[model samples]
Target chain A: MVTRSFPGRYDSLAQIGEFIRGITDKAGLNNFAAYTVEMAVDEACSNIIEHAYGAEDQGPITCTCKVNTKGLTIILEDRGRPFDPELVSEPDVTGELEDRPSHGLGLFFIRQWMDEVEFEFESGNGNRLTLYKKRTTASTKSTRQK
Target chain B: MEITHTQYKHCDLVKVKGRIDSYTAPQLAETFNKITDDGRFKIALEMSELDFMSSAGLRALINTQKVCKRYNRGELVLVAIPGNIHAALDLAGFIPLFKIFDDVLSAVGNF
Candidate 1:
């Protein structure tokens, strides 16, 4: 298990990506799986920075990654405003192109990519978002061929 | 991320390379805004070299597409989307939003 904390700002996205990439690569996750995990974590962190901390608040987002036989697990910790994931409505993805909405896709993407996602709020710990992705044989084979 | 534009006969071709996350999505949005502002509504985004894209990138595309639709002149199309990016679009249920082609020339010609 490896854990690192970054400033809750957009600028830290690159570092977060690098951190995810290192762990996924070390764990031998295929490109597709690794990319999926990276994007999921990216969206999660972005939400914490934008929605939780808001633009005016500069907090710290701590990320911990663990890889085992099952798959990779990522935990994002932020001491910002508490948020309820269930309150986010599903995006109208089937809507006409002209009427498509943009704001809700981040949480949508996060839920779609990760195998499991759980959000918890603690009085002192703030918000903890845990994301999990399972490695499949298909992913390993596809990645090896690439 | 690097965005390069080329003027075609029927549409404008924008080729994107590198990752499109929260930090870089604004640049893409700016490029699309500039293209539409210049009255070039028929556009083809070539994504063969684009390595990765998050929801922020998707939002930029959706916003620009809305702009093109609002003008009633032409539409923005996507071309040569890589497998991962295409999967992301599919997962987000956004595949049907635009005309997607396998090649840039074909996408531009359709405009």
Candidate 2:
């Protein structure tokens, strides 16, 4: 497992992307799979900076990447405002453009791209977002092709 | 993200390169705002070099599309979208919201 902490600010997003790409690439995830994981992590970190911390540079975002025989697991922890998923509905992706919203899609993408997503929050502790991605023989084969 | 504008006879082309996530989406949004403020509604976003985008980038596109489409003044079109960025547009159900083209000439001619 490799862990790193970054300041919860917009400027940290690029560094976060680099961190995820490096680990995902080293883990033998295919380009598409690695891209998906990178995008999901970006969405998760963006949400932490936007909603959880409630402001930029307000706290710290700790990210961990662990590789196992099964797949990869990523844990992101933040001490910002806790978010209740129940209150936020799936974004109306199929809705008319005029009726579309900007708020819910980040969380939606995080859930859609990752194989598993679990959110845990405590009042004094922090928000822990755990995401999983399964390794596949297809992914391995494709990586070898490159 | 870097955005460069090329003004056509009837349409304005905004070449967007680089990744637009939560951090750089505002730059794209600000670009659109500047275009609309200039009363140029017909705009084409060239995304040939775009490598990645998240929902924040989608938000910027939708917001600008809404503004350009208001009162049927004009519309925001997309040109030469990369494979990954195209998937993001498709996933967001934004494929049908704006007219998409494979090249810049066709997209600019659309205006």
Residue A31, model 1, lDDT = 84
The runs of at least 3 residues in candidate 1 whose Cα sits more than 4 Å from the true structure, single-residue gaps closed, are: A137-146
Over the stretch B8-93, how does candidate 2's per-residue lDDT look in tens digits?
A: 77989999988888889999999999999999899999998987888888888898999999999999999888765676677778
Q: Native contacts recovered, in order, as a fraction for each?
A: 0.65, 0.46
What would the per-residue lDDT of candidate 2 be over residues A2-71, giving only the tens digit for each residue?
9999999987888899999899888888787787788889999998988898889899999999999888
| Model 2 chain A: ten consecutive residues of lowest lDDT | A137-146
Question: TM-score winner among the candidates?
Answer: 2
Give per-residue CA lDDT, model 1, range A1-146, as digits (tens): 99999988887898899999999998778888888888889898899988888863479999998989888889999999898998999988886776677888888888877888999999987999999888874274342110
Least well predicted 10-residue stretch by lDDT in candidate 1 chain A: A137-146
Candidate 1 residue B102 Cα shift, in angstroms, is 2.0
